[model samples]
Target: MDKRLFKEWESCVKCGICRSVCPVFKEEKSEPYVARGHITLLSELIKGNIDFSEKEAKDYLYKCLLCTTCVESCPNDSHTDTIVEIARHEVIKKHGLPTYKKILSKLLKSRQAMDFAFKSASTFSPIFAKKNNKPRDGIKLRIEVAGKDRLLPPIAKQTFLDKYGNDKKSRVVLFPGCLINYTYTEIGDAFVNILKKLKIDFSVPKKQLCCGAPIYFAGNFEDARYLAEKNIELFLSLNAEHIVVLEPTCASMIKLDYPKLFMYFEDKKWEEKARRVAEKIIDPIKFLFDQTDVLRRLKKLPIRTTYHDPCHLKRALKVKDEPREFLKAISDYTEMKEADRCCGNGGTFSIDYRETSLKIASRKVKNILDTKSEYLATSCSACIMQLADILNLKDHKEIKVYHLLELIDKALEA
Candidate 1:
């Protein structure tokens, strides 16, 4: 942890300005869960004024969604996300990860294990669907902690990496995040098709792990750093000029979090490797937009879609225009009110604070509905899942949620 960065973050005035703009704070109306309060807590920790029993520290650190909205809103640009991550790292160093988190992180470390689980789930999915009378297209797997009724997208039959393998023609290394790989292979397939059409050489590494955002947000920074190191090595081995990531959260972790976390490495070569990896990281939409002839081809599609800017993509990366431009090319696109607002699905934040998450997503859904869009498109896989779950519950079946690349790919196919 950079002591100077931590000190800067510790000096927040708690002026409540962050609360005024924070979606989570807006929904909950609570300081404890707001960015300012989180910084104040870290301030106390840094000053040696309070001891965080493992549970207390874990709980506080886990409350953050790491959406980067607060950073955008802060006058000082206090780097709340960095401070939170550092606090999480400290906690994990002091106390080992919880049992469930440890298991999940372990599973996330192996693509083979993730693939096996997805295949198994896909095989049994039909049987379970028949027994429960749930439509195969819309299956809700109940995870107890997040809430039993939380609807999950069904697992894909084959991961994108499995289907495409590592083609030498592919100059870029694409990291299809866990959700995009296992739950929304259509999005992954669409991305591949677009890449093919653009003739952008790309490779999907066989051993890529979860970008580790979930574990990191859950206060398991040891696992997060471990996954980061593994991923850094994997990308370096690929020897690709660039790394393209489908999920905004994963991209943010690679481009922002990994370098920050690994900056203090004693080995200069490892630190240099981390920096090189960060440079090559590109969000899928921006990459697609840069290849504009693809967009020119997309301009002929007949469908209409509206976009939801995932907070990570919009506020964190400032990638607000690329998705809009991509959508405009293909369809009669409508910009929803508050298009860049947080969908409240802050990875595990939705699980940790259900009501608040839903409140924010509910507002987002209302805006999507108001647009009368045939499809609601976003760049983040987790945003798609969260918005879909909310829309499903509200019986808003007419509007579909999809990744932007899926829409672009469909246009190309037409």
Candidate 2:
């Protein structure tokens, strides 16, 4: 019964503008799937017209991509996405998490457990996930656990943090996040290379954990808060001048959502600490863009590349131009149609609802193909993973997906 969530539920005028922009509605064409429709149902529940525990209500809640595109278009700035998250928290309070999700949450909380599991997964994943015939990026899996056609990048034998230890403290700290640490070490490798090439002072914090985006996004608010508290304390201890996050979602979660999490609890001390930490948090692309030392070294990469804006970077952080600034400086930049449109990754949404996620991603993939580019670049690792999967499924072996840092690292190599 959050007042802010209640306000958002009542604020929606049912304008249907959100309906037109919703990717899920485009695929499902159902009343429960669209933002306005979702708010409408939520409002009905608040008014006692519908039950919150109803399967229909729960299905509608989880079905969202959580892109916040609706917020971008909403005249009221209603924040339907925030309301949806709050509603999810409500649902979790009543039903508790499924057994698998509970186990996964525990894994996220432990460093040693995650390291062991991923180490095991790295060695055994190939046996489980078959390689694609046209594999350029990640290996595709037809296995039931991987869903119908999920393309998971091969796990790194040695993680970035494991390879590059925090020998001594530096002015800058890079937060590689979960996806980059385990699945997409290429981005992590590129990040280190770019920093080295630019002669930037940085260290990767070995103790830094997941930014708890997955937990919070999954409606495990308390667990998400636990993660945030741990990360905040560890970051404060490092006392770096800049904490450049590799994943856009991690960046936004730390910069924006971290403060909100504390404010709701009326924890003045933690909220202040979060704001201080937020000041130092920057996306790696933005960090590089601000570095004149790096700017002077940009080489015009002779490759045609198109940029896909991660929803977190574009909508949450308002960081649409920072990454593009790098692309414009280094590569033959092509603007894809609706470049800021959500690729339908929605964190684990792509895993849970594969067919719907893929259908939504088709629109984005078509937009990328329309650009006729050699490579697809984005700020978020999850976005890169999602785009790579959809492209692999379509048999587009020619195009490659890269993080902005990876592309920047390429320029430095050239």
Candidate 3:
């Protein structure tokens, strides 16, 4: 058990303020699904008051979407996500990972293997991939895998790294994470175009792999640390002034979780290096916002849009205003109800608990409908995946979803 996290757990007052903000609790209305319930269970297990079993642990721990709303709502400001992650780590340490997690972890460990897998998936994906009638931004590929509908942006024929080799003269390094590299190349393309327009020297580091967020969230902190070390070395080798990421989750992981991963490292040099790397980490949206001349050049778009605040982007990184301010400047922006609310696509949370994930997502979709906006702009790719699916699932074709970068690219073109 993490001592710091145990202390943090002890501070929880069980005020149920977390219950009001928790998306899962709102949908499930069950104690186990809420932060207080899980914290109580964790406290019991830690104190030897309750027996820990794989089945019992998985039931409570995996239920969280890790949106951090509970933590934000709590008066004690307990690190619910961290506590839950530790609980997950303990559970996995005792009994080992399930079969799917083993396969996913292996894929995250290698870029070549992941590329090969996606290449294979791409070959067969076209057989089932269908174009959406009301495509908004990005190539909407609607497909059904095992009878479950998934709305994904078409995978790039070649990745951003494949197309844009490392430029030694570039000061900025663009970290196109797995989602942007494999599934949403348009987002990557837009980011690059925006950089080009800004005349900001940048490179896409080919050696960099997934931010290891998938593995970390899976409770495989051991492998997550290894992946983080690999990325840190790659960035250190570049000596780039800034590391820009489009996906908020990847940015949050590198900026927040990467250092946490390094805490276990005994070597002071590596820990110092991790901190250095964290300093250079930047969100493209925030970076672009800082470039005043770039904003002045963008033509105001006439499109009406609503913004979905990605939980990690808003709650974790506290990047609430930049995207909205940028959107408001570029387009006629309207605020959606509970814009910072979780879209219920907490990486594997959606995959593992599909019914609960969709239940939460339905409310999110309804909120989007309430906005009556033609476009839905957000900072996180995970949110994009969930928003796209729920919109398609409900057959609500009036609005199309976009990454904020895509919108910036549009404004730049305009």
RMSD of each: 2.7, 2.1, 2.2
What is the overall TM-score of model 2 with all chains considered together? 0.94
TM-score of every model versus the real structure: 0.91, 0.94, 0.94
lDDT of 3 by residue, 74-191 (tens): 8998878877876787789888999889999999999999989988877776665765544343334454442276666666678767778564646888898898888787888888
Clashes of 2: 0
What is the C-alpha local distance difference test score of each model? Answer: 0.77, 0.82, 0.82
| Model 2: per-residue Cα lDDT over 259-353, one tens digit each | 87776567879989999999999887777777546766788888999999999888987887777778888988999999988898897788778
lDDT of 1 by residue, 1-414 (tens): 445565557557677788877786786677777888888887777567876998788667777678778888788768888778767767777787778778788888777777787899889876554221121144755435456667777777777778876635346788988887887788888888887877776777777788888787766666777898899988877777768888888898888877766653344566677889988898888887774467666655677788988988887677998788888878889999988888888876787678778888888878888888888888887888788888877778777787788777877854
Number of colliding residue pairs in model 1: 4
State model 2's lDDT.
0.82
Runs of candidate 2 exceeding 4 Å displacement: 1-7, 43-50, 132-135
- The positional error of residue 195 in candidate 2, measured at the CA in angstroms, is 0.9
Backbone clash pairs for candidate 1 read 170-201, 170-202, 171-201, 171-202
Sorted by lDDT (best first), the order is: 2, 3, 1
Residue pairs with backbone overlap in model 2:
none
How many Å off is the CA of 38 in candidate 2? 2.2
Consecutive 10-residue window with the lowest summed lDDT within model 3: 138-147
Between which residue pairs do clashes occur in model 3? none
